[model samples]
Target: MSAVSESISRRVTLGYIASHYGFELEPRFADGVTVTSVADTPDSVRPGALYVLRDDEEPSWLSVAVSRGAYAVLVPPSMAASARSAGVPALLATPDKATLGALAADIAGTPANTMAVFVVCGVEDDEIQADVVRVADFLHMLGNPVGIVSASGSSSLERELDMSYPLGILDIQHLLAVCSEDGAAAMVISADSQTLRPGALEGVNVDVLGTIEQLDRGGSQRAFKETRQRYGFSIDEQKRLVTCTEESGWLAGQASASRDLQSQRRLSLAIAMAMDAGVRRSNIRNALRVSKEMR
Candidate 1:
């Protein structure tokens, strides 16, 4: 898996929010590799890897996390100070509001897309920290998930951290679900399921539907074009329907109205099938009612 994907699999990670305003950094060396490491101090550093910093008194990890072309560094204020003094450009201190905003901007390279880094260890006075809220908001706005480690030592958090990397065992079920039947639809709907509308259903598998539409709008005048172009319909049968409908234009209009009714029936049938597949009857019923109105 790619480094970004791998990084995403981990629930809680340690990285700093760099302050952009203070310093201009130039790469001292290019490691030409990607590594994943977790360390308590500078010695835990790998030249080309992403490192997670463990809480330590010395703050040596801060220097290493930011140095040698590292992706980011995580440190408390005391350690961040020392790292800054040592010329670590991308250092971020815990629980600092103004600093996190400045640091988030630096990491993302744009003011709008503030990315978040989840810290495995809890910050001091996290209960009242506005920076944590900002971090959550920033991640949320970007539709990114950031899992921070709390001092509570919650097992849930620990499980999340272990599986946050790409293709981790914990994420396999999600991956499989996305790759299954209606998987493409599942992906689109699941991503923004709360906001999905019937109109947006066409977007669920846009590439597939778009190709069908392109075939319908052929250069030559062809019969049965619309039906053949629609999803889940075949060309010959579509042609026959069109031919029959055209033979009786007046009756075809009435038939068109009936066709809509039939489509609603089919949709209702689909909902019933879903209900049979273990969806709650109420949900299926509501969905069918909503689909009818949408139609």
Candidate 2:
């Protein structure tokens, strides 16, 4: 089995979840019951998993999850009575997307806390992918194992990113845990507006944030200045690379040139993010040289 699979196999007890997230437990005795996985649909429930029922779901599905040997259930307040009478460990909570994310992260051991997590957002899908690739390549060249999670897919330098859950808090946290288990020192997550919604990133630690400049693409006038001022770096449009105003000459010619404006902007943002993560100037220069030679 892969490292992530191995990590997923690790179990957590209902009591731990309740205590960690401050959820009210029904029938107090179910605390000792262990859950190996979490599922939203009854069809996905395993023998020792916890099934979270949404408010929109039919009440009858609760029995279905119980029949499938779900060790525990996290249900909406309205279902508390039904869950209590179902003869299993029950947790009373909102069961919203954010709540599920927090639960999933807890179950996965909250791995994002273990390494530097860089976030890339506010850009197109292709640009996000390009930025992620650049960041991952730079980190890997510096001898730090890195993991990547993008809208297209998830991967790590050491192995393929395998996940059974959908791309939400659960899948993302699980992937981060897997990367941590596989010894990744850092990770890059490509997030769009959907993924940036209120509860999407719950329990994950984001160390740095970067956004591609879209000034000429009808972006807000304050976008470029705000990002540069906040992050201390900006794209030098004339040179097609990043300029770190805080550390003059830090990345002079270390960035690889790109003709496409979008690619250049993404590349510049990626380099700036790497700099924020404290990558040494010498390492950046060497990584750039190595990347150029390989192209």
| lDDT digits (tens) for residues 195-291 of candidate 2 | 3333456667567766654434235335544433332222333322222233322342445455555554545566677786778767767776777
Q: Cα RMSD to native, each candidate?
A: 19.4, 6.5
- Candidate 2, residue 62: Cα displacement in angstroms equals 2.2
At residue 17, give the lDDT of candidate 1. 17
Per-model CA lDDT versus the true structure: 0.28, 0.65
Give one digit per residue, the lDDT tens place, for model 1 in 82-120: 655545333333423233323222222221112111210
Off by over 4 Å in 2: 1-10, 95-99, 162-166, 193-198, 214-261
lDDT of 2: 0.65
Ten residues in sequence with the least summed lDDT for candidate 1? 203-212
